[model samples]
Every structure is written in structure tokens, then in C-alpha cells.
Target chain A: MRRDVFQAIADPTRRAIIGLIAIQAMTPNALAEYFDTTRQAVSKHLQILTECEIVRQEQTGREIYYHFNPGKMKEVADFVEPFRQLWEKRFDQLDHVLRKIKTTKK
Target chain B: MRRDVFQAIADPTRRAIIGLIAIQAMTPNALAEYFDTTRQAVSKHLQILTECEIVRQEQTGREIYYHFNPGKMKEVADFVEPFRQLWEKRFDQLDHVLRKIKTTKK
Candidate 1:
């Protein structure tokens, strides 16, 4: 199944994991030290993130470095872009209406 | 209960509702006409959105106009802004590293 970007980011732990790995590529062991949780938990979240295509692994020798996938993140940015603009435009419209209402009242 | 911004946006219906209202304030009945689903289902989503503070209801005569709460949406926008930047930065680093690797190989 293709996991969606929204569900992948639903969990707080997963969100934290994304933040930790986004700044720099990290191995499971090194990544786990940031949180109070066990390495297994971090690994599990990584698996889910990988499935969603939000995080990807690169193998260097025996070590795996998980890095942020910018292309995958473009979808999320796309999801939010319209909503952001829509709200701003509506607010501007509302402002104009309010101003008209005030002028009419005056 | 304080509903979080994450779960509130997890549903496609909720996100659509947000988009609709973001462009302009809408009533539940008016909003329902946009979808094939029942008005009650749309109303339920409106309720959840109101609880999360993402949508606000305005009383105009007997009709309630549901408006997008831009302040509340700031949280969702905030959650995404950093990830976008981080991923871009990391991708640039990866590009640089890959170019170096190519040079070494040649």
C-alpha cells in the first residue's frame, strides 16, 4: 500500500523523528540517542517513514544513513500552499467587507 | 478536549472543508452542496473543525457563516515550514557530495 504524507506525519514521535533526521542523515543507533525511547521504536518509525517515501536510506559500508527526501516533501508543501493562499485571500476579502461595513455605518 | 491541528487535517473531507471556507465563509448547508455526501456528514466535520479552532462560525441573520481561522492554521503552516527548509538544505548537501563522488570516480 502507498502510505500518504498526512498519515505519515500524524504521530508526534514520527514528526520528531522527521525533524531529527531532516537536519542530517543518521543511523538508527545514533538517531535513537535524541529521544528517551528505545532504538527499536525509532527504527519502527523509520520503517513507516521509509514506506511513505518521506525518508530514504543510503548504505555506506555496513552503516545505513537515513536522509531527508526533499522530493517527497514537495507533496506536503503542495498540500499546504493552496490553503495558505486561500486563507490569506479570504482574510483580505473579509477585511475589505469590514471596511465597507464601517464606512457605511459612519 | 483540545483537538490537535494534526488529527483535524488527517481527513480529506476536513481538508476540503478548510479549503472551501478558506476562500470564503460558508454555511453547513451551502458547503454540503459541493460534496455528494450527506449534509449531516459535512456538519459533523464542521463541528470537529470548530473544536480544533480551525473554523469559526459567524451569525448573519439566521444563517451561520463558517470562516477559516487563519490563526489556527498558522500551527499547521508552522509545522511544515521547517521541514521544507531542512530538506532543501540536506538535498543541496547531497548534491555537493554526489558531485564530489563523481569527480573522485573519474
Candidate 2:
């Protein structure tokens, strides 16, 4: 999958929005109250997040309730797994090299 | 750190460049040759990646070799940890809920 989800989360405001939804579902206006930005700006970010499927918005009575979509975030975690493994392997090698140097010093 | 590293990786070409360097270091011309874009375009992407510290380029003899900077990648991994943990927790909850439903059905 493309890294659009990760890119969608690159913005601090978007990340904050995710954090908010992760805790509880809220309407756009409710979310806007927590941020310094206007509701339209928050709505724009929320739209991008929704496009990326990071957040799902549902109509609850008259208001739209935005909540965290764990499924989309799972995609991000899966995408990062390979890179994470690569880093871990590199770190292991570095650790081995350091240990060898320490043994030589001893 | 901000998600600039994550945003830096949002581009497919940049991701491809990182994959190329991950295997072995290469010159800008050589890296550009693997892609469909111009050398200048590749250079621009490289500059952004450098700004995010995702890749490092160094002068070796007369050629500038672009290599995978594992250090910068470590930062990206660290940045994603909390998000990853949050997803894992959510998944665990989902799994738990599913198991409970299954048991109730049984």
C-alpha cells in the first residue's frame, strides 16, 4: 500500500486530531474547540484523514461523530514493519561490532 | 521529532531511492538512471530526504556516494513507536472482543 496514510499523519494538527478521536468520538465542532484553528481547517485535516481511512466519520443523530479507525493505522504499522526489522538488524550488527571492539580493548 | 521523516518518505520515488541505497550506496547519476525522472528531480528529492536526515551523501574520492543513513531511520522508527503501540493495543482489544462474541455464539 502507498504511504498516503503515513503522509496524512505527517501534519501535527492531523496527528492531534487522531489523538483526540482515539480517546473518544466527537463532532467536528467539538474537535475544533480543542484546537486553536477554525473548524474549517480542522474539517480539512479531518477530510484528508478520512480519505486515508485513518479516521471514520459516522452520522450520529444530527452530528457527525469522528472516531479512530484502528484498521487504517494497522496498515501503517504493517508498512513500517520491514523498515523496523531492517533497523533492528543493523543495530544488532552495530552492537556486535561494539562488543568486538570492547573485547579488543580488554 | 516531527513527522517530517514520515512525510519525506511519502513519495514513491523517494522510497525507491531509499530502497536502492538500503542495498548499496550509489552516485546521484547512477541513482537517477534507475528512475524515470531527471537527475535534477532526483536531486531535489534527495535534498528533502537529507533535510529529514533519512539519507546521507558523502564525498568519497571524486564521487559523492549516497548511502543509507541507518541513524536517521532509527529516528523514524522511534517516532512511530507510540503509534505502533497504540495500534497493537487496539488490535488486542478487537481480538478480545471477537473472542468474546465467538464464545457467546458458542
Candidate 3:
């Protein structure tokens, strides 16, 4: 099955995993400590993330660590950024209205 | 099943639906025209979008228009913004290194 960033992040656990790995690379066992789930469950999430290239695995000293791939996450950020800008513009307009009201009252 | 913004946007078609309505409120009939699916399928997608409050419906005479809810989308933006900032910082550091290399070469 073809997986994408959206599908990879659809689960809250996956999102948490992304947040954790984005800060630092971690093994599945290490990552499982942060959640109430088992290491196997965390590994499953890691698999989905890896499928989408959202997280990459590196082997060092007989241990594997999952690292965040910001390039893949760029697809998500790019999708949300335009909407964020649109909402910010709306908020600015609302702020302008409030400022105008305050001046009128004064 | 509980739905959130992430779940609402998991599918490519749903994301396209959001992009369309974000520009302007659209009826299910109008939305169906943009897709190869039936109106019922479009309604199902709309139902999921509404369940998560990502899109809201407004009744106008006999028509119900789906409007984008920016507040709900804030959750998504807030989650992605920090990671985007982190990657941007990394990119800036990379730029610094590249500039130093260029300067040394010149």
C-alpha cells in the first residue's frame, strides 16, 4: 500500500512519535518509554513513518535509531502554511476592527 | 469513531475538498462536481469533516453550504509550526556553512 505523510500522521501516537524524533533520534525501546504502549506498537508506528520517509532508521553500534526527515514533513507544513497565513490575515482584520472601535470610543 | 483534523485530512480527496471550500463555501452538489465520486460519497466525506468541526454547514434557504472553520485548523497549524521552525533553523545553519565554504573558496 502507498503511504503518505497525512496517513502517517493520522494517528495521535504517530504525531507524538514525530514530535519526539524531531527533537532527537531514538530507538523503538527508548520511544516506548514515553507512551503507555509496548515497544512493538511503537515499532509499528515507526514502520508506517518509515514507509512515508517521515522517519529514517540509522544503525550504530548494533542499535537502530529513528531520525526525523524534515524534507518529508515539509509536505505537511507546506499544506498547512497557506491556511495559517489566511487565518492570520483574518485575525489581523479583526484586530484592526477592535482598534478602530477603541479609537471611536475614545 | 472520534475524528480530528488529522483524520479529516488523511485522504487526498478530503484535502482537496478542504482546499476548495477554504476559498469559498460550497454545497455538496457543487463539491461533487469536482470529484469523480457520487454525491453520497461526497456527503460522507463532508460528514467526517463536520464531525471534526474542520468544516461547518450553513443553511441558506434550501441549500446547505460547507464553510471552512479556521479555529479547528489552528490545532493542526500549532502542531506543525514548531517543527517547521526547527527545520528552518537547521536550514539556516546549513546556509551559514555553505556561505563560509563559498567565502573560503573565493
Candidate 4:
């Protein structure tokens, strides 16, 4: 199943995992070392991330390193772009209003 | 209670509501007309949005209009900014690799 970037990032733990992988690719074992949770739990989070393609695996012979795939995050940025534009416009409007108030005071 | 923009946007319905109000400020009655759901249901979505302050309420005399607050969306954009930069860097690396491959082939 294709999961959205939002679902992939919904959990704080998953978000942390993404953050870790973004800095450096790590094997499942290496990635698990930083977390207090059981390795199995960490593996489960990786599985979810993998399913969403937020994390990609690189194989070198027997070694599998998980790397963060930042491109997948575009889904999120695309979805939020309209909202962001709208927000900036609102801020501009507010700025104009504030300027008008200052001018009136002056 | 303060809510993160991620939580505010998790629901598809809520996202749609945000999109609607972003274009134009609308009252509960007007916003409800677009959905198949009941007026109360639309109001519930509006309530959740209002609580998060993503939809700010403007009261003029007896009229209450819900307007999309674009400022709140910065949380989502901020959280994803690092990931976006990472993605772009990776793309540049890929482009470099592809050019190197072509040069080698030549």
C-alpha cells in the first residue's frame, strides 16, 4: 500500500527516525542503538517508513543500510504549498493594517 | 490547548475546510453547504480548526466568520524544511552522477 508522507510523519518516533537517517545512513542495528525501545519496535518503525518510501535501503553484499529519502517529503510540501502562500498573504495584509494604524497615529 | 499544524491537518476533511476558508472567509452556514455532512458535523470540524487557531473567528456584530489563519501553517513548513533541503541536495548529487556517467560513456 502507498502511504502518504503525512502518515509516515504522524508519529514522533518515526519523525525522529527520519531525522537520524537524514544525517547518515545506518543499518537497522546501528539505528536501533540510539533508541531505548526494543530493537523489534525500532524495526517496526523502519518497516512503516520503508513502506512509505521515506526511508530507502542500500545493500552492499550482506550489509543493508537505511538512508533517508528526502524526495518523498515533496508530497507534504506540495500539499502545504497552497496553505503557505495563503498564510503569507494574510501576514502581508496584517502588516498593511498595522502600517495603516501607525500612519493614523502619526 | 495549543495544537500543532500537523495535528490540525491530519484529517482530509479538515484540510479541505482549510482550503475552502483560505480562499474566502465563510460562516458556518455557508461552509456547510459544500459538504454532504450535516451542519453540526461541519461545525465540529470548524470547532476543531478554531481550537487549533488555524481557523480564526472574526465577529462583527452578530456575525461570526471563520477565516483561515495561514500563520499557523508555518509549523508544518518549518518541520519539513530540513527534509526539503536534504531532498534537493540529493537531487543535485544525482544530476552530478548522471553527468559523470555520460562523460565516462563518451
Error of 1 at A58 (Å): 2.6
lDDT of 2 by residue, B1-106 (tens): 4437767767778877876776677888899998898999999888888888778889999988887775666655554444554566665555454444334321
- TM-score, model 4 to reference: 0.73
Candidate 1 per-residue lDDT, tens place, B1-106, comes to: 5377777877877887877776578999999998889989999999999999988999999999998886677666766765554456655445454444334321
Model 2 chain A poorest ten-residue lDDT run:
A97-106
lDDT of each: 0.75, 0.71, 0.80, 0.74
For this target, which candidate reaches the highest TM-score against the unseen true structure?
3
Tell me the tens digit of each residue's lDDT in model 4 across A1-106: 5367777787777877887776678888887888888888988989899988999889988978898787888878877765554556655555454444334321
- The count of backbone overlaps in candidate 2 is 0
For model 3, residues A1-106, the per-residue Cα lDDT tens digits are: 7499999889989988887777678999999999999999999999999989989999999889999887777778767766665566674454454344334321
Looking only at chain B, model 2 earns a TM-score of 0.70
Give the least accurate 10-residue stretch of model 4 chain B, judged by summed lDDT: B97-106
Pick by DockQ: which candidate is best? Answer: 4
Cand. 4 Cα-lDDT: 0.74
The backbone clash count of each candidate, in order, is: 0, 0, 0, 0
DockQ of each: 0.24, 0.19, 0.25, 0.28
Q: Judged by lDDT, which candidate is best?
A: 3
TM-score of 3: 0.81
Evaluate residue B87 in candidate 4 and report its C-alpha lDDT on the 0 to 100 scale: 67
